[model samples]
Target: RLAARSGLSVGRLKISVVTTAKYLIPSLLGEFCQAYPNIEPEFQIGNRAEIIQRLKQNLDDLYVFSNPPRELDITTDFLTKNPLVVIAKQGHPLKDKKSILWEELYGERLLMRENGSGTRYAIEAFFKENRIKMQNPITIASNEAIKESVMAGLGIAIISQHALNHMAPGNLIELPVHGFPIPNSWYWVLPKGKHVSNAAMAFREHVTQGLSHKKPNEHA
Candidate 1:
């Protein structure tokens, strides 16, 4: 068949990812495409809930997540570390502080991702464990919006370090809050018992080999 003749070098590669992975997956995908110029990539970016819904429906060849859903019977490969850190506007009072306590955050306005976001879930669990109660936290849907709000002095937020990599210099700074960088990682998921296309297999190998060469923090 023509499909066999074209091989992995020419085919549709479908991938879906959580919004935070938007800052990371595109460039790697671009490199993959460069090596196989004839291949077409169908990339979808959504919040954790949306991506999970897509996964449930088996809509994509691969799915990327910082917080992989535990309820799903899927296979996950650890792609890279995605450390979540607290962030604030460049000139905030706590900017120069050291070993900031978790209780100190209680007095500050917390900016949160919308309902069903993986980042929000992780933050809420951490806060619950630490017995810190947020006061009327604001909910922003996208990472870009959250960063913008922080830059405008709206409030501090907890987000992946990868999100800050794409931001312009000198606009935002990570707060050295204790028990921070919530220890997260990106995962590549596949539905159980699903057939793996050659294109998908190739991409998985490309990502694994590519990321292996860089330091944990340099995955971006």
Candidate 2:
């Protein structure tokens, strides 16, 4: 009886997410909190492998990812589209070129996300399918760090456009590399056959309805 009352009186919504969704989910969560101010919202952010491990252990209420783990028994509800693109510091030689080729990007120094990152996986998949061996690339963990490095002209990187939205205008601009704007989405993920709490279920519905009203090409 007490637990039920607590669930109603002070709902707790726990969420886990890959870094790409880090920029968007918080704003949505903020809106949810206003409607349920007493609700305690907990968040866990990590690379794909770590987040999936927690899901295997049933650690939290919900999980978000851009690249869903294959062959895993999980319930996936598509939340929002996440566009991934290549970006470089403003004023780079390739900055002004509108029509660019993937082959051209190969010769330039590249920066990549750390291991087990969904962004890194997507980048690798692109290279694999094209049969292009990625030249020596620098690996950086933090999304912001990658942007900063690119701004310093350290190296260009493939990053989620969601992260790019938060950067100052003109500081980092998308490079129109071939086959870009890689189609990806943030998913409301759950462990298959596991019990989902009422609060989580409510938030899932909230997210679904909220996204349905959005334009197809809306920025994250």
Cα-based RMSD of the predictions, in order? 3.6, 4.0
| Residues 22-107 of candidate 1: C-alpha lDDT, one tens digit per residue | 87777677677777677798999998999999999999999999889989999898888888899999988877888898677777
lDDT of 1: 0.83
Model 2 TM: 0.89
Residue 201 in model 1: shift from native, Å? Answer: 1.2
**lDDT: worst 10-residue window of model 2:** 1-10
> In model 1, what is the error at residue 112, expressed in angstroms?
0.6
RMSD score of candidate 1 (Å): 3.6
Clashes of each: 0, 0
lDDT per residue as tens, model 2, 13-92: 78899987778667666567766678798989999988989888888988998888867989887778887888988887
Worst 10 residues of 1 by lDDT: 1-10
- Please, what is the TM-score per model? 0.91, 0.89
Which residue segments of model 1 deviate by more than 4 Å?
Answer: 1-6, 215-217
